[model samples]
Target: MRHSIAIVSLVLFVLSMALLLTLAKQAYIPRKEVRDLAKIYLNTTYNPWNKKFTAMSPEGVTAIVWDYRGLDTVFETAVFYLAIIGSIALARGIGKYSKPTSDEKKLGLSLIVKTVTRITTVSIIAVAVSIALHGHLTPGGGFQGGATAAVAPLLILIAFSQYFLLERGVSKDLMLVIRSLGLAGIGLTAIAAYFIGVAMNKYAFVLQNQAKPLSEVSIPAYIDGQLISGTLWFFNISEFFAVMAGFTIVLILLVIPERAFKSSGGEEK
Candidate 1:
């Protein structure tokens, strides 16, 4: 039975690779001419001479995601937030992971893996921060950076054990707080310019990045002469924390052994 399954898997893998290779000839190739909507974005994304229309970010993709179609991104973020909340509700009061139980004392991988994780985890976190913070100037943005940040804790959980993180005060409650704050920050950043407009009695739109022709209100694109690209930088940083903590919460909950829950008289969700 095992050999039969293996033969089927091999055939499936071969077929998938062959199909991908065929598509690589044409489907994945870049088109030379600019399309209509894409051309509009490329022209206005970082144009200082066209501040009223521009998102004022070097990275066109980030501008499009957070500025051009921001409301759509907000809805997507809300869906992820709701999913996390649902998981937390389902997994309530199952375990306190501050210290390991006797059965867990012998957990974690070998010393070589642990040592490598220690080095790589810190570097990975640094890269994630840079990716989120500099997203308006480069390729990556909030979701990408947050996903990258989550990998560090995941590696530590596998390599050095969950107790290592628990001992270091990386608890679910703390993560929840961080996640909540990040979400709040994103919300505030979204409406910040609108509130300013109300106070000054000028026209402004929610999620507005650069000042439009009708509204003089604008989120500062620069801070102390540094190009933060208005709401894009704040959104990226907030989302980085929110996604990182949310994913870490999921990991911590998932790492709990079934036997552990059973022993504690907690029914599995």
Candidate 2:
């Protein structure tokens, strides 16, 4: 049976590779000159002269994702967060009744691996932060950076142990709080201009990052002359935390021992 499964997998893999290679020959090449909808986004993404259409974000993709069509991305992110919330609810008390044993505390890889992971984890977090904070300026953004940051926790879980992380206050409750804050930040940032407009008795859209042709209200594109790209930076930072914490929550729950579920008389379904 195992051999049969392996052969079938190999055959499927080969077929997939062949199909991909065949399609590669017909890959569409982009035109040299920007035109149509893309041209508009590129022209206005960072135009200081055209505040009406400009998102004030230089990075076209980031501008489009967070400023031009932010609501769409918000809904997409909401769906993912909802899934994580459901997972958390399902695993409600799987680990509550079980405490890590003294031996579990000492369980991990060799000293050299642990030392390497210590340095590696720190570097991973640093890179992730750089990716998130500079997302408005570069190709990387919140989701990418947050996903990268979550790897550090996974590494610790593997190199040290889940108990090590939990002992260090990396609890699900704390992560959940952080995730909630991130989501709140996103929600607030989305309507920041609207609130400001209300206070000033002006018109502004819910997800307005910059002033439109008709609306006078806009989020500040710079702080003390430092370019923040309006709401894009805030969105990236918020999403970074949200994605990282959500992933960490799932990882923590998965690492909780099956026996932990047994102690709570729960099957961890």
Tens-place lDDT per residue, model 1, 1-269, is 76998999999999998788787874455679878999999999989898789898999999988999999999999999999889988887664333455665467887788888999998999999999988999899999999999999999988888778988999898999999999999999999999999999999999998899889999888899999999999999999999999999999888876766776777657
lDDT of 1: 0.90
What Cα-based lDDT does every candidate model obtain?
Answer: 0.90, 0.89
Each prediction's RMSD over C-alphas, in Å, is 4.3, 4.1
lDDT comparing candidate 2 with the true structure: 0.89
**C-alpha displacement of 261 in model 2, angstroms?**
2.1
Error of 1 at 182 (Å): 0.3
* Top-scoring candidate (TM-score): 2
**Pairs in steric clash, model 2:** none
The ten-residue window of minimal lDDT in model 2 covers 96-105
| Cα RMSD for predicted model 1 | 4.3
Clashes per prediction? 0, 0
